[model samples]
Target chain A: MNDVLDVALRLVAVFVCFLVLPLVVGQTEHKVMAHMQGRLGPMYAGGFHGWAQLVADGVKFAQKEDVVPENADRRIFQLAPAVALLPYLLVLLAIPIGPSEGAVGQVVDAGVFFVLAVMGVGVLGSLMAGWASANKFSLLGGLRTAAQLLAYELPMLLAAASVAMAAGTVSLPGILNAFAWWWVPWQIVGALVFFTAGLAELQRPPFDMPVADSEIIFGAYTEYTGLRFALFLLAEYAGIVVLCGLTTVLFLGGWHGPFGGDGLGWVWTLLKTAVLAFVVIWLRVSYPRLREDQLQKLAWTTLVPLALAQIALTGIVKVAIQ
Target chain B: MREPTVVAADAADYFQTYSVVGVLAVVGVLFVAVAFSANRLLRPVVPTPEKLLTYECGVDPVGEGWAHTQVRYYVYAFLYVIFAVDSIFLFPWATVFAAPGYGATTLVEMFVFLGFLAVGLLYAYKKGVLAWT
Candidate 1:
């Protein structure tokens, strides 16, 4: 039937986006970091500024030996990559790329809650990898992950709740429809808190104590090799895409182009997301990793209070406007 | 008759939406499985004892892998539980706060709730539980 075909096509589109966007972001990171550091990155991989660098990397990963440590819990060790990677794909499904109904993969009623809850589930993947690997560093990494989750998750939730409160909706599309220009400056503090907490949740640099390579030897992924290791890397990039996309929708006025037209809304959404993704990578290049104490301190003493204030601000403003 | 049919259609659409999510998850797992199996076929797995042993920066690993880690951040976990439950209340309040006539009342009520949460966080902060070191 036409309905079945339509659903299949949408799933395929989402699947392709899931596969492609992460690689694009990964490639951007390689090139951007290289350029920032005055290195040539991968000029030779695909012959044209390494367009096929990640493709080559994929091929290389496929050809590399898959090694499960002798002491690892074999099943969970192998299962962790899928666990890490799948949640982003689910989160992507609920995200609205434009104002139209067809722009989203699935129209969940509680889309904001769905995305946040699903994203929180992804930390378990690293925790599982860390615990099951049976390496000392891996265990330490797992513990750091749990600690990081504890520190950052509350502010992230509170910040997101502020947006939902400001918009007066829990649905992603509904939020987009309700977005006004003043909401940007009005919710700017919440936006920043949400983005910062989101970066910490994704365990991106500066908040990447869980996987501090110098200290913990890649942390929970110390034992992962070849394609399995590559999948975790992909998950990190996919996470970047999701976080940027969510920030775009919730705070940056999803699909609200500066030119004032809805027809090219998806383009505006993608553009804003790309710009934010660049900032994510730029932050990585600009800052060093935070120490454990500093990480927890910023989340609790800084982001948490700031997010609470943003919520109270939103409440007062909403009441005043009414 | 039409009302019941409309509700049934709405229910069907909801399930269909979630079923797509389920399918996407399965496809994701399958994507990994397929790539892994392909790697298994292509890669030369000549695992030696040295390779199979856990990596510890080119030296032999010391102590048990499951060593006694300090539960220094256990308090964070406890804090996480309290705040996570508090956040659950905030979500519904967020939706309710914007409704007409409920704005001022909901704003005052939620602040009281947040005031309590702030007090708890303040207590933990003062007690030094929020400090990592």
Candidate 2:
């Protein structure tokens, strides 16, 4: 049937995006970070500026010994990477890539809540990896992750709730349809809070104390090796793509361009997401990692309050306009 | 007869949407499994005692792996629980807040709810539970 074919094609596209976007982001990070530090990165791997560096890296990882620590709970340690990697793939299914109904992989009515809930499941991956590793550093890293999640999760949720409030709908495409140019400045505070909290949730730089390589020896992933470690690395990059894409949808007017139509909408969406992804990498190059205390203080004292104010402002303006 | 059929169709549609996510999850797991199995075939696995030992900067790992972690983290977990429950109410309130006549009332009502949560956060702050030390 046509319906079945349509579903199959969409899944294939989502799966392909899930595979490709992360590698692109990863490669960007390698070159961008290298250039920022005054070096050329991976110029020889694929002949043309090392275009295939990540592919080569993947090949190399496949041949490395899959080292599982003897003291680890082998099953959970092995399972952790898949757990971390799958949520982003699932989240990608609900993201609207264009204005039309066909743009999304699967149109869930409550897409916002679905994405948030699914993304939250990724925290467990790190926790499992940390606890099952049976290493002191791994356990500390896992505990740090739990604490970090507790601090950042609320602000993220609150910031998201502000956007949902403004749009008066929880669907991703519905939010896009409701988006007006003015919502940019109006929702700017919530956007910043959401992006920051999301970065912390993904354990990205500055907020990456959970896996602070200098301090924790890569935290929950300390014992991971070979393809298993590579999977976790892939999950981190995939997470960057999802977060940037979601920020684009929720705040920056997904699929909306200066001259608007359903045509070329996907292009605008991808372009905005790529720009946001650049900002994420640029941020990594710019700031020193925040100390644990400072990270928590910023989330609680600054982001949470700012998110609350943004929500109040949104409510007042909505009522006033009515 | 017509009503039951329509309801069944609606239920099927709901499941159909989620089934895509289900398939994607399965595919994700399979992607990793395939890569891993490929590695298993290609990689040399000559494990030694030293290689399997818990890595601690090339030194012998000391003490038990399950070292006593600071109990301070428990407090954050507790706070997360309280706030998470509170935020769940905000979603429905958000929908109602933008409705034609419900705007002002929902705004006031939601603020009261947030005010309570803010008080809870303030109490924790006053008690130094927010302090990392």
Candidate 3:
């Protein structure tokens, strides 16, 4: 009874946080982007720079349309968004949200691998969404996403391995506990590789060519509209948050604030994820998406090699420290 | 700069701990329920022929939404997965290789693992998966 109740509570929290996140942390990115572009952001929607903009967007998407193509698979079309969104929800179950004092979060043994494996499975949604749309553009989008995800997943995992070796555990908390010092200095290479891989994983700008808005009208998501489409978008943003959360936990030390002490652990975790998320959005607004061929070259030639070297360095660090 | 509490807890035990906390589950269910319900009540609905048209690069459908895509796309994805998984497994093995007493056994296990990984690479190469043309 307690276990079920506990699971329910955790899931509910994830949903709530996910809902408000765009309004909170995401607002920072939007405001920053707006200031950069010389425009006022979101002031009309909820007053005070559109605080309720995301809510308004969600409400609008629901009643817009839920079209099913004449020849497309009905079941798959309906199922696609759900599939795409499910992994992100599941991914939340294993991440540590706050410090030990605040919440008993960060559930799971081998949190690092567990989070990545589940997150990687998000490709299924892309594949299904693209195929079920019965649109070539959507199919191309799905194809592109699957390839992009698979290409970068390796380097991301390998980069995490460098941290894993230093920390000597795959558990999120374990990785946090094992931090001899800040992971940024010695682990900068792995950190950079991981951040780049994360862009490809989230299909963010520069790497977001798969969903190129102008070229494909949102690509795999073109066929979707209304609430279902909104769900997919929410899931995408949620996945980014989860990715940043995982990245922070794995390398920055889960909930342990910088300059020592875990008292304000939750603050550090939130702020760290927010900053990373901002940087991600910043890059999106500033850079152009890579061509498909260029994207592949980045994964195979650049990121993979960098990840391998970082992993090698990790081995040396482990031996030297001991 | 700040670092998280980098302490080692039993991997399995940590999971047991998060389950005891009642945060994430709460947020997930409440928001999903609200998202769907709010749409049901608040949004207006009036469908039209124009709205129902299949999207074609933001224009009216050209010929059909469903068109044949290149088989090469699928092949590339498959090859990418094989390489990704190989490296994924290999990295963990490498990390564990340096753990004091486990070197010899880890090495043997790794070789066996590498053997499987090698076979897949060879198959893909033989099938010309890496070739763009």
Candidate 4:
């Protein structure tokens, strides 16, 4: 009975966090990006920097007519968004938001591996959306997503392997407890590679060829409308949150305070994740979109090679120190 | 260091973690379902023939909806399979590398393995398989 209650409570926690965090961060991303681009975004929605802007957008999306393309595959088209969003929430389960102790999500021995594999599944959702649409643009977009995501996944895993090597465990909290300040310096190259490949994997700008608005007219999502479109948007924002969370745990030492003691350690985790989230938004605003060829070249030629070298470097350092 | 209040004491406890994951997955699907269903309830569904037509920049879509895609896509998939196999060996090698007895020998062996893959990558590059144009 106690175990059932425990699992229930954790489920509710995951639900609330999964739904709310993305909405909040996504709204903040709009305001931040607007400011960066020299405009006032969402000023009239709810006043005070448009706190209710995201809610307004939600209601607007809900009220809009749901349009299905006449030629599209109805079943796969409808299923794609849920597939995209659900795996990300599953990732949150293994992520230790607070500490290794009470008030955390599930702890698996293969946490990092699980996160990496599940995140890779998100590409399938895009592929389905693109293929099911039956539009040439969607097909092209889907193909590009598959190529770009699969290529980048290699580098991301390599970088994560370096951290796993350094920490000697694939679990999130285990990696956290493995180091103090030195982990960052030791895995800095791995962190950079991970962050870069993560941005590409998430299809953010500078690596967002899959949905290049100018080229493909929003790509796989071109034919989607109403709540279906909203689901895709939600998935993208949720992905940003998950990537930020993973970066925080893997690179920044999950939930550890700088002063060497735990004081509402989840607060520290949130702060680090917020900073990373801001950086993600900042990169979106600052960089121009890469062409498809450039995106593939960057992933395969540059980042993968860099990640391989970083792993070799990590191995040498570990052997010498021990 | 303070002990973590919740620890997996046995195999039973460890397996319980998967149940939590199962619960979360259900919740996620339910969340999407509710959002979609709510939209269906509150929104007016007055779809016209024009609205349901495929979007093609205000121009009528020409040719079949399904078009031929570039062959480069398949090439990328093939290359990913090679690297995927290579990285599979890498993850376990990383974990085992840091163990006390397994040091320099493992390192050299893994590098030799990587060296062979590197040669494959080099061949691909030389063959222009990685090129976009």
Per-prediction DockQ: 0.79, 0.77, 0.27, 0.67
**Candidate 4 structure quality by residue, lDDT tens digits, A207-321:** 9999998889988888888788888898899899999999899998878877645767888889999999999999999999988888888878888888888888888888888
True-contact fraction per candidate equals 0.82, 0.77, 0.32, 0.73
Comparison by DockQ, 3 against 4, better one: 4
Deviation of model 2 at B62, angstroms? 1.0
lDDT of 1: 0.90
In model 4, the clashing pairs are: none
The prediction achieving the highest DockQ against the true structure is 1
Tens-digit lDDT string for candidate 4 (B41-68): 8999888999888898889898867897
Better model by DockQ: candidate 2 vs candidate 3: 2
Rate residue A207 of model 2 by lDDT. Answer: 86
User: How many steric clashes between backbone atoms does each model show?
Assistant: 0, 0, 38, 0
Q: Candidate 1's residue-wise lDDT over B18-120, tens digit each? A: 8888988888888888988998899987989888898878799887688887878878888889889989788877887868778778878978987998899
User: What TM-score goes with each of the models?
Assistant: 0.97, 0.97, 0.84, 0.95
> What is the fnat of model 3 with respect to the true interface contacts?
0.32
Q: Return the candidate ranking by DockQ, descending.
A: 1, 2, 4, 3
Docking class for candidate 1: medium
Name the runs in model 2 displaced over 4 angstroms: B1-9
TM-score of 2: 0.97
lDDT over C-alpha atoms for residue A81 of model 1: 90
How much is B84 displaced in model 3, in angstroms?
Answer: 3.0
